[model samples]
Target: MSSRVQVVEQPGLAPAGLDPDAAYAALAARDRRFDGRIWFGVTSTGVYCRPVCPAQTPKAQNVRFFAAPAAAVSAGFRACRRCRPDSAPGSRHWDHRGDLVGRALRLIADGAIDDGGVAGLARTLHVSERHLHRSLVAEVGAGPLQLAVSRRAQTAKLLVEQTDLSLAEIAFASGFSSVRQFNDVMRREFGIAPSGLRRTPSERIPSADPALVLRLRLRPPYDADALGAFLAARTVAGLEEHVPGRRWTHRRVVPLPTRAAVTEVTVHGDHVVVRSGADVRDTAALVRRVRRWLDLDADPATVDAALGLDPALAPLVGAHPGLRVPTTVDPWETVVRAVVGQQVSVAAAGTLLARLVAAHGTEVAGESGLRAFPRPAAIAALDPAAITGMPGSRARTLVALAAAVADGSVALGSPDLDEVEAALLAIPGAGPWTTGYVRLRALADPDAFPASDLGLRHAAGALGLPEAARALGAHVSAWSPWRSYAAQHLWTSLAPAPVKEPS
Candidate 1:
């Protein structure tokens, strides 16, 4: 451990039992494990850096810890250029909490405020704007608006460093209201003018390049092969393509509401590369969705610690240390797939889904060889018999789901998991298994588990564990907040090895 990074252990970091000593120790050791969980701001230098920063650490008395990047900025610190603290994986603490604060953070990351402002976000979460602001301040040391501002600053910084977009364009694209606001925020948060921060032309890639590529950082022990295999098995023919160990491609409406693009996601060693043909304006939103799809924000160390205590799961955890639950880029798309998957094998269900997309999906205009999944309105307008191969009951359920979403009766990406599940169950054919699967994949719920699924039961039996859904459900309750991940491990035990295929 570096002496400059070392600090005496102390217990007074937060009321939530976050130990300052532990945070400092991780910083001293230059441990990447704590990169997102704790950020150290140096009082003397007025800059904050990630725990894994290679630069010499500041003295203990000069160090202050913050739970989030926004909190550190609130205390008058700029981001360290050397370490790029803003790019760390999101804190696992927020991902595991099912409370209002947690959900609010997730929504904020998804650009809810950028799309609708604080009032709209409040409406979606079924809470008052004032209460939401108060809760965020008390829990995370910053209010909703400030959190949104911090997010924009991070996005702007990335653009400045990685792309050759003009300041005006980058400002508007990153959700800033004006070029002046963008410049002011950059100077305030990073202690550098926006133009001064930009790399020389040759050092950065032009935004007009055919593919907009960006690197997504994630925690170690990630089983990329497992995730690739899981998605490849469920991919729809035209809407998605997967070449195991190389890339996964999909076509979707980016930035929510409007822009359309084709995205190719590839997993490298510790980072995933997202290359898209979307407009430069939607890069920030595209990055956010891709991160969710890969579950890159999940904290693997925390997950391993909790699941490793169980004897049955210990070996599996050891085998696949950083296994993550694969999620969808679009909530409606996930719901449609779940409905199609009812009472079918993975391959058969994929075929039916591909047929549905081919019939109703809006084809992309370029050489992307992709089609956007039908919007809720498009699906809601259809007769049940219009979907060729789907069973009458399943088709009706899909239309009902589309109607609910279109009518604002079921908010897909809202922070309220209970409300989403209840709305899903009210549909005619959606049962516990379907609701659980949707929750896990669409809403990104960490604890969602379809314990009654036949595949899960088979995996449990093969592992010499409880074979009954009810019994297995009881046994896995101990894996609360991580049952979704446990289900992945169990399911992977039965899945065949991934093989490369043409894209």
Candidate 2:
């Protein structure tokens, strides 16, 4: 983003040149690489915008730069009436960060910071509040509260733009303490009043189909065809469907304060439209989970460039740069899906997973009539024979898997992939492939190499196991923490030809 858009705030802010000419050069070129990290504020127009903004670039002398939307607004620049910086892709740090900061961002995205205070967050992260603040500030150029306040303000802005929600409701739902607080934060972050952000509510998008409609983004070269085919084949009969046009629909039960809900996701180009069939009581949290599940937060250029160098993967990377490693919001759902797929054809596995959900899951309170995926506790307590119907080894495996997850033995979203594998391996029926799948998909581990996976091996054929393993390891090491995404792309190449989209 032109050396971070040449951060030229107050004079003597720093030694960095932050040359206006360089920043203007980047803005005029309309670079997508600067999508989120840096933003441009045109002094003449009294507006700030994303680097990829389609509007005409302002004069270089009339331009300024800010580290964040909040910073820009705090400087008296209003959001660009045209580009709407509030809705731009989130901060880069949010997508790539790990450790206390990453976890804290995830929690904040999920409304933890809103619902729970700093102490609550500290307790959940199992660290002192002081430590949490120190770590966040060190890593993200902002502390947890700054990050969260930004998030809450963004949520409030979105609710204003999209929904018929009252400002006060938006206040609470967006995690503000009061309407006054919401307004203040919005003004501080957006440089616009709450009333200023609103647009007339149009006729609602028809939800005739089973689709959860919302906007979604990924880095370039997204193989919509590849993703569509994969999702279509594996969708559950009753709960999920991937239409021919690359539109995907999957039912998920949304949890709310008053009750839970059944929501569907309709993912199309550039946006994943969510059809709640219920109030978007807390649109922020729902949006956060959708981003996670779709792996929308990944930076593909960084990942593809790293993993694409391998001779074996170079071709696959060439074809599918936008390939994403599918993830789930709930680890229990992920483990169960993995278990259901065991020894079964992909289609059969999807059907069984749906069946298991139907048999055990509670009906969601909202409109779509879908049910929640069974929780770990629910599955753990179920009769193994009733669950499997085939009463043999698979049943035993399912039971063990459920028990382990139910008791926290299998840490699905664990930072420790090895720990997850160890926990899953402890279960009788969980094989190396299943454990690896869980690690790769559920835990989001980049290095979770499933060498035993037939698909991976076949995809790696001619390279030979030792050689494949060595090459893959070396190639993916460059991919580092994002290797899971690389593995997903490789696996996609190996998946049966009549590919379907994710469930």
Candidate 3:
């Protein structure tokens, strides 16, 4: 289905448009459905708030609805104090679309612009800087620089409220060039000095252990129990622990001035609380990457609407309303896992991966037993014969993949999905299933489906759908852009017993 709202290039209004009367109605109702996707700037108070803000609603004439927070900010409205609009979950609008704008937004959230600058971002997207800037400004209400600043402001706000770190530390940690720049942006964005936004001492993060506790927001109807079960089944020994109805802990190694941390994630109502040993400097990146790994930003309503149309998927969709395609925090690690998992059960793959980690992965500090997955460089340095418990052919394939990644031949972080797939396919013994799994988990591609997998084939057979991989692919075309979610539902339905309900 197409989007209902259209974009109009009007001055002093958002670039994206909806009927003003309807937007005001949604606000009056305090509609949580539109909370993240829409913001209303109150002319009377000169503040912008989410549609679901609890403060008294302003008169319709005094309100202007924006498709994004940036549009309201660009129009000269500061974030509302009561609502804290920046804390809302990210717009599912970006997650459901696969356009240039959507891809750019995802990359920005991942700190691509912070690491590469606008010029580097454009180069990675295979577009000229002029074209990229113009396109962004026309589609959204801001240019690349403004969007990046807005992102940094959000990060800074979270740090100020949650941590006891000095303003100077928070400044550079949030990617500001200097304390002066940070101070200026804070005033402009929040209309307060950084110190004024500090949390109460009782709420402050513990100073002794020095960890950052932050919330990862998401749309409602999240199936936490299901997600926990999936991760628990695939947990690699010494690298991760998943306790049902409790918490999941995993070690992460972040790129760009490389750092390591162990993250503990627990799902609260409509949000996930994350406790990480990553320094305040790395917390913003860690949170963003973990959100991507869990696929938290996905819009369940949009996905369900699309996939529920199919007779085969309709029941499963209804049963599992918020099923997510589990992804990896590390792209290279996911690729290696996919290769090791080929032609094996989930338990067998976990054992092999645990052995690989014991042999080559670095031991990292954490409350839980934590070990960083072997980096491409470390894996490449190893002798193929040393990677035991796999066929010699598979061992050679793993060695070849590691060397390619280490030497920059098979780039996992490429912006171009086609190029990444092509590079993966070019390597010997990296088959279609392995490549598709990597794309689905590592790249966070929502449309990727490993149609050749035995589980999927069996599921299709039981459902009386096309059983062959090629035929199944053709039949599943209607689930475009959400096939990965559909596959998860199919896999869940294949279990002999009914799947447990969320706690």
Candidate 4:
């Protein structure tokens, strides 16, 4: 193998621009910013670790840096026991790119591989299995299966450390098919059996109930207040709930592959506590969706540094250092929400969506009082004339979108943003704003900006920039690649000031 790192010249997967020397420097300094962006394997000990791993740093000559954790494992290295590199927040480098590698990574993280296997994943990406395997190996130093294996190991380790799920439960929950396979993979990845990886009693969270409680890590300075407020303001009555305060709690019905489960998230300091009763088969998928929903994988320091360069946005960036564009767990829900929200105020949109959910959504079991957002098939069955409280045109648009989604003509799971956008635009009533908003929240496209939005236009005009969509788009071009964060900053400026309570 060459001493130099090999990358496939992709846009966002350049290891965050770190060469071997720079990667070593970051590793030696235990830099938190580079924690997820790069991993270095120790040639001597044959273990890989995050840059922020607290163990003794290996000699520079003994280190080989990789852009992904799967690469290290593929290169014959176990995870560092002390550092638990598998627990590192996901790299934001891959979050925004619409490329093949980026999309593949996203799907793999979402348990596409576990659900359907490598052949299935290739089919979804519309590539030959051979081509997909080769591309992934060249770009990220691992094939799709290897990447999925690494992900499963990570999930299993997390369950071992955090939840009190039985070993068999953890195995299946992490996407392993058999206990033997799970044990072998765990030993190979971590140099220990699954049981050996469990945390001490004092360190573990007490699992007194059936709910799987896990603490998801966030790259700080996370603005929990800002994220909570954004979700709370637009919460649908039967589908979501938010209890607002200094430390807020948000709950929503998440539709998993096997079934729909209600998931609860509470903000605790640097991390959020996630409580879910999802099936063991769906636990890994639920965790990945929760991470996306919370925007926990973002590199706040890098985003803030980039946006802070603009004088107009500098103040907003400074005020809300880690303000995230809160995304959705279900892309269909986002599409429906975006379409229904058109030409209507946020409050009105929520009321209308609530009506739809109550009428068509699947109610959760027991008395949680939550209902999963109506799936496309459910909504597609309704006649446009039956959708109350919305204009006929908008109602027709919603049904049309539902039919498209139900038919797989508009694949929300597709990695190709342009293709998805084109298909969405083909719907009769879906316009630029609807497509743009879907791209931003549903697809988690960081550069996605609904420039036509009145709120965004007003926010830009207040900042002394152009108010027209075309002009504002031009002005905000400098915020490229990070425009989603820039948009959040702008919209946040228009929010009413919070009342101060007596100290």
Candidate that would win on TM-score: 4
Question: Which window of ten consecutive residues has the lowest lDDT sum in model 3?
Answer: 1-10
Tens digits of per-residue lDDT, candidate 4, 1-503, equal 22233333223333668666676788889888787888888877778888888889889877777778888877877887777687778866876787888989988888888779999999988999999999888778889999999989988888898877789988977778899999999887887889998888788666667887888888788988788779889999999898777777888899998888888898777788988878767768888889888899888988899999998889999898888888989999999999888988889999999998898899886578999999899999899998888899999999999999999999998878899999999999999999999999999888888899999999888878899999989988899898999989998999975443222
Clashing pairs in 1: none
Model 2: which ten-residue window has the lowest total lDDT?
1-10
lDDT tens digits by residue: candidate 1, 282-348: 7778878888888898889878889889888888889888998888789899999899989988888
How close is each model in CA RMSD to the real structure?
3.8, 5.2, 4.6, 3.2
For each candidate, what is the lDDT? 0.80, 0.66, 0.79, 0.85
Per-residue CA lDDT of candidate 2, range 1-503, in tens? 11123333543221113455665676789866556666767766667798788898777777776556655654566677677776875543343345676777667666676667889889878899999988765444456777678877776776677666678888887777788888887776666689987876563344455333345445455555666566666666545544564355566565544455566565566666666654555567677766766666665665677677767677778778778766666666777777777766787788788887678877765455567777777777877767654447787788778788777777664444465688888888888778877776676554566666566656666444233545545544555556676667767776655435344
| Candidate 1 lDDT for residue 242 | 67
Ranking by lDDT: 4, 1, 3, 2
- Candidate 3 residue spans exceeding 4 A from truth: 1-33, 55-67, 95-99, 204-208, 246-256, 366-369, 496-503
lDDT by residue for model 3 over 1-503, one digit each (tens)?
11122333334534235577777888999876676777888777778898778999889877877766776677677888887898777754665455677767767777788889999888878889898888777667667777888889989988888877788999999999999999988887777788889999788545466667887788778877678777877888877776654444433444324567777788777888777777777766777777887778777876888898998789888887888888878899899988998898889999999998887888776555568888898988878888889998898899999999999999887766667889999999998998988888888888888899889988888888999999998888889878889888888886644345434
Cα displacement (Å) at residue 74, model 3: 2.1
Evaluated against the true structure, the overall lDDT of model 3 is 0.79
